[model samples]
Target: MSATEHATCLAIAAARAAADKKAEHLAAIDVSERLGLTDVFLLASGANDRHVHAIVDAVDEAMHRAGAKRRTREGFADAHWVLVDYGDVVVHVLQNEDREFYSLERLWKDCPAIELPADLAHGGSRDGDSLGGRETTAS
Candidate 1:
């Protein structure tokens, strides 16, 4: 089965949160078929530990605001590869080097990617503004 609407919504919010913090290489993978543990995996990378933590905090706040409880959180101390598991959706905020090393996108290449909101589809705004709480250019 594919991811439910709730899971997709959570993933979108998490992605937006990451983008707001200037995260890069944002992507959402539908892992429902491969892993029953969670429906979606939201991956993003930061320039450094500080940026990673900012992205993680933003994602955590956004998810919690949407009423999703964080099931598990890992790698926060190092801020190298923080994983925030929110039952239906898991957000991975990693440093650039760690992201390259792990290469989750390659490992999950078989799974279909979830299309994010037009503005958040890329890691930044089309007009070169920050994402998340920013408006997008109308179609």
Candidate 2:
């Protein structure tokens, strides 16, 4: 599969994993055109530290089950913003405060947003908005 296709699959798999753990504010940013090392950035926010860890765990498990290897993982102990790097895709499982503070969406605003599966897009509500409040329609 192409990079875009692979990124989409990874995004959906990550989203499903996050949803299974009842994670909030799950969104994936397609950074293939913007970044060279990775094709996508999977961003998800959790209610608290525990939830953040759980979300990251779910993402790791899903990616592992897909035969993907992690290049590195960081911020697990703090649980504020756990990052899981999978070569072409980097997953960020963060708490609301940390997510807002970092504001990665704004940093990568220039890149076109990706369209995720309907269920993943509207799965949970966070901070009165739906996962960055960016809507994606499957074409």
Candidate 3:
């Protein structure tokens, strides 16, 4: 009833890739107990269509590098929101407005959140480059 270790690792890798693309408000929720198809949901927001696509591409590439194959992808043409299903981990790269409107975190509020590394969460990686282009301050 929990995310497997491989799934967790893949989700974290996807999260970092999203961060590298300047995706905002990144979150990974363990949906193992609620969903039979996937164990984790990795959510991220982009400022616009281009940003959303970029984040999705980054996440896909990172996951593949980690040996996870994408099962399917949705909403790529519009780029309003993109869902990359990686079997164990499902990644959502969404536009800022869409992210606010959907409020996935609220929908899956009961799910346990996966803890990302401080450096990655803070947008500071080992390369010393800020992961995201713009930082959103907590209100």
Best by lDDT: 1
Candidate 3 per-residue lDDT over residues 1-139, each given as its tens digit: 7999999999888888988987777777889999999999988888899888888989988988999998999999999989999999999888767876777877887788877656566332223322222222222
- Residue pairs with colliding backbones in model 2 are none
- Residue-wise lDDT of candidate 2 within 1-139, one digit each (tens)? 2347877788789888987888766667778776788998888878899888888888899999988899999999999988899987898888878877887877877677677766665344445542455435353
The all-Cα superposition gives candidate 3 an RMSD in Å to the true structure of 6.5
What are the lDDT figures for the candidates, one per model?
Answer: 0.81, 0.78, 0.80
Q: List TM-score per model, in order.
A: 0.86, 0.86, 0.86
Residue 65 lDDT, candidate 2, scale 0-100: 97
- Estimate the TM-score for candidate 1: 0.86
Candidate 1 versus truth, CA RMSD in Å, comes to 5.7
**Model 2 regions lying over 4 Å from their true place:** 1-3, 122-132, 135-139
Residue 84, model 3: lDDT of: 92
Which segments of candidate 3 are over 4 A away from where they belong?
A: 122-139
- For candidate 1, lDDT tens digit of each residue in 1-139? 9999999999988988888888887878899999989999988888898988889999999998999999999999999899989999988887877876777777787888888776764454333422232222223
